[model samples]
Each structure stands twice: as C-alpha cells, then as structure tokens.
Target: MTHKIAVTSAFGVESVTKKELKNLGVRDPKAIDGSFVFDGTMRDVSRLNVFLRTGDRVHLVLKEFPARSFDELFDGVKSVPFSDYLPTDARIIVNGKSVKSTLYSLSDCQKIIKKAILSRLSEDKRTTYFPESGPTYEVLFSIRNDLVTLSLNTSGKGLHKRGYRDLVGDAPIKETLAAALVALSPIDAERPFVDPFCGSGTLLIEAATAAMHIAPGISRDFDFLHWNFFDKKLYEETIEEAKSGEKKQKLPFAGYDVDPSAIKLALRHAERAGIREYVHLQARDVKDLSHAKSHGCIVTNPPYGERLLTEREALELYKTFGDVCKRLDQWSINVITSAKGFERAFGKKADRNRKLFNANKECRFYQYDRL
Candidate 1:
C-alpha cells in the first residue's frame, strides 16, 4: 500500500531535501514549511531513510483532519488504523505540538491522542492494558489552526546523527546542514574542496560522502527496522543497492583548523565516516590557508562569536579571511556566519547571499564565485 511520507528538514533547506527526494525517484515531492511530503510505498520509506542527506527525519504520515475540540481531536486520532502499522505488543509514544490552534494544551492533546490510540487497539487485541514491552513506535502530531496532522516517526534519532562524530567540538554544525552546504556549493568529485575553519570537520566529511555517492545512513539503523509490518529483507536490499552505487573517486578535499585538538577530533571523525583516506586534514590557521588547485570551493562555518571569541576577535578573523580570499582569488568561497557586519569585515560583498540558520541562531551563507 502506498503511504504519504513527510521528510523533515531545516527551514532554509526545503528545496535541497526535495531535490534529494526526487533523486531517490520520489514522484512530485511537495515542499512545505520545514518539511516535504511525498507518496510512496513502505519500500520507499527504507530508501528515504537510507539515502536522504539533508533531511532531518522521515515520518509516515497517518492522517490529517480538523480538531477544534477535544472530542474532535480524539475522534480524529482514533480513526487511523494504527493496527495496520503497529502490533499489539508495540510500545506507543505520543508527542504533540500546537500552533495557533484552539486545542492548545499540549499535555492534554498528547493524553487524548494516546487514550484514543489505545481504545482503537483494544478492540483488535481484546486487552485492557498494553504491556508496552516491545519495539517502540513514536507517533507525532502537529496542530495548526485547528487542523491536526499525525505521523509515525520512521527515523528514531535525527538523520544528522550519521553514527559518526562521536565527539563534537565547540559550535559544531549539524551533519545535515553540513551536507546542504556542500550540495549548495559548486564542488564535486573532480573539484577540490576545502574548509579552513573545520570545526569537527563536518563539511569536509559530508563533501567526501557526497563525492563518493555514499549513503549517509548506511552505518545507521532507523526506527522502521523494528516495525512489525516492514520487511527486513527489503531494507537489506536497499542498503546493498546504496552500497553498490558508491563510486571510488579521487576527492581533492582538505580541512584545516587552528586548534590541534580540533584537527585530531576531525581526523577521528573522518576515520569513523570511512573517508579518512580521501580527506586531508591539518592543524593550521585560516590566515595561512593556501592551495595549488585553482577554482576550488571553500565551504566553511566560521566562529559566530556567540559563545566563543569576542565580536572584535571574530571581525579580525573575517579580515584575515578576506586576506586569504584575495591571495586565492581563483577559488570560490562559501561561508556561513551569524556575524552582523560580515561583508564589511570580509572586505567585499558576496556575489550571492542566502539566509540560513545554524542551529537556533540566524545566519547567512555568503557565496563568492571565482570570476
């Protein structure tokens, strides 16, 4: 049976997530706020979880209906055939959010939804209480202006936890956002890629995986793997297909950080990501960045000065970055920073700028292409 799936992403990367869905052969992916919806089979669920790079989580959309009152909300949730996807032994966890909706009590909404699901399942299993000692099925709900959308969480942990980066440095960029930064740049397998301010080396690692066409979720397991209805063999086949599609390409990628400890952590992360062989990492300041390759791409997340470094220090770093850019004018530069006067400090305006969010802080990705 075909199912409606919602793939979640960061606010600014809806388009990137949609493109990834399309690349996975999802038909007519619909872009929405913070997510993209598509229709596919259960097999597509496996494919999406295994291959999506920029997506935060994959959810199996269950139902959407208006719920202005508590009774309406309970009835709306109870109408879904949870038995089809969940077994009697399945542990159900209900999470909810309300935005500009009449049923604004989140705890009450969660309680009502949980009770409704239990009532629906009780009829099938003839049990008053579920033992709840089984695989988990996380149900999520969003109520917007009295319309409720419910879905099952197919991805357990967020996709950004790609099983690598067991340790993170200060102000580390998320793996999903790092992948988006690489996808937005003009870097490929053949082109050289560099991240001078490589805190935790997320961008370089993501770039290496992209260059090799490695599925980000290859090393991880999804919540659907524990579902009763999903075929384990199909998931295994999907993973094998992803493995087969990986190409052994020579990726000219380098990452540098001023802190030796950060470089050490980055190298360990690279090793964990299975791209240490393709990536070159060194402990060096951004001001000393130099490369023999011309027209390469430098995609980096610099220090935002929010917690680390003063505003003056961050500005000085940008000035040094400007000097580095002038020395390597042939290379394209893509920088994500929350600094207010970034362009003024960088000594030139970006050819293009995109609004992005680094975690909760609003930031801009300044792109300067080599002319």
Candidate 2:
C-alpha cells in the first residue's frame, strides 16, 4: 500500500535530503520546511531508511488538517486508521511541537492526541485498557499556522546515531550534518579529503561512506523493522543491494586532531564503521598540518570558540588555517564554525558561505575554492 512519507532534515539541508530522495527514485518530492514529503510503498520506506544519509528520521505521514482547538486536534488524530498500522499490543507515544498555532500547549496536545489514539484503538479491540507490551510506535505532530500534521516515526533514534561512535569528543558534529556538509562540498573519489579537526572522525567517516556509496543505515536497525506492516524480505533485499554497491577501492582520506583522545576515538569509530583501513587518522595540530597532495578537498568542523576554545584562540586557529590555506593553493577549503568573524579572523573572504545549524548552534559553512 502506498503511504505518504516525510523525511526530516537539519534546518538548512532540506534540499540535500530532497536530492537524495529523488536519487532514490522518489518522484518530485515536496520540500516543506525542514522536511521532504513524498508518496511511497513499503519498499520505499525500507529503502529510504536504509539509504538516506543526511535525514534525521523517516516518518509515515498519517494526516494533515486544521486544528485550532483541542476538540479539533482530538478528532483529527482519531480519524486515522491506527489499527491498520499499529498492532493491538503496540505501545503508543505522542510527541508534538507547535509554531504560530492556536493549539499551542504542546503538553496538552500530546496528552489529547494520545487519548484520542487510545480511544480509537480501544474501541476496535473492544477493550478499555491496552496492554502495550509490544514494539513502540512514536507518533509525531507538528502544528504550523493552525494546521496539524501527524506522522509515525520510522526511525527510533535519530539517523545521526549510526551505531559506530562508541566515544565522542567535545563538540562533535552530528553525522547527518557531517554527511550534508560532505555532500555540499566538491569531494569525489579522485579528490583527496581531509578533516583537520576531526572530532571523533564523523566528517571523515561520512565522507568515506559517501565516496564509497555505502548506506549510512547499513549497520543499524530502524523502528520500522519491528512494525507489523513492514516487509522483512524487501528490507533484507535492500540491505543486500546496499552491501553489493559498496566500493572496494579505498579513497585518499585522512583526518587529524590535536587531541590524542579524539584521534583514538576516531580510530575506534572508523573500525566500527568497517572503514578503518580506508581512513588514516592522526594526532596533529591544525598549525602543523601539511599534505603532499596537490589538489584535494578539506571539509572540517573546526572549533567555534564556544565549547573547546576561547574567542582569541579560535581566531588564532582560523588565522593559522588561513595561513595553511595560502600554502595549499591547489586545495579547496570548507569549514563550519559558529565564529561570528570567521572571515575577518581567517584574513580572507569566503568564495561562498552557507548558514547551517550544528546541533542548535548557528554556524556558517565557509567555502574557499581552489586558489
């Protein structure tokens, strides 16, 4: 059966998510704010969960309607055929967010939506109490301008939890955002890639996975796998397809960090990601970074003077980065940071800059083309 599907992305990477959806054969995906919506079947659901690298989560859209009151919200939620997707023993959890909506109490909206779902499902089961001992179904709601959109979460944990990083450094970039940054850059198999401040190696790992066409979700389990409506064989076939598509050749990629602990953790993560042999991680400061490669790409999430370094130190580091960039004239540089005066500190204007959010921190991805 065909269902409306929505994939949530980081605030500024909706276009990347939509591009990925289209590449996955989703025709004309509609880009809403922070998400992409499309119509697909069970196979599409499995494929998306397995293949989407930059999305936060895949959700099955249930309904969309105007909800200005508690009564309207209740009726709107209760109108969905919950029994068709959720089993009798399934546990239900409601999460909600409201923006510019009359039904603004998020807590009240969640409680009412849960009650409505229970009320509807209990009627079908001819029981008042539902012993929810089975798998979980997370119901998500977003209200914007008095219109409520309801969906079921198909990803349990956010997609950034790729099940590889057992340890993380301070201010580690989210894997979804890292993958998005890599996608935005001009890195390919031929071009070498480097992340000088490779905190926990998220950027390098994501870059390697993308260059090799490895699915980000290949090593983890999703919420839909436990659902009653999921097609297990189809999902297995998709996994096999992803495995078969893995590129065997190792790309030229390296990561360096001043923190030895971060480098060790990055190595461990790379090992867990099954790309340890492909990624060369080392403990080196940004000032001492040097490469023999003439032309390559440097994509890194550097210190933003917020958590790890002071403003003065961050500026000094950017200056050092600027000096390093001047030496590597054949390389392109892409740095994401929350530093306000990054260009001024770096002593050069960026060829292009894009605003992105790195875990709620507003950041600018400054790109300097090869010069």
lDDT per residue as tens, model 1, 263-371: 9999999999998887799999998988887679999998877777889999999999898888788888999999988889999999998898888889999999963
Q: Give each model's clash number.
A: 0, 0
For model 2, the superposed segments whose C-alpha errors exceed 4 Å read none
lDDT of 2 by residue, 87-109 (tens): 87888888979999899999999
TM-score, every prediction: 0.97, 0.96
Q: What does the lDDT read for residue 333 in candidate 1? A: 92
Over the full model, what C-alpha lDDT does candidate 1 score relative to the true structure?
A: 0.90
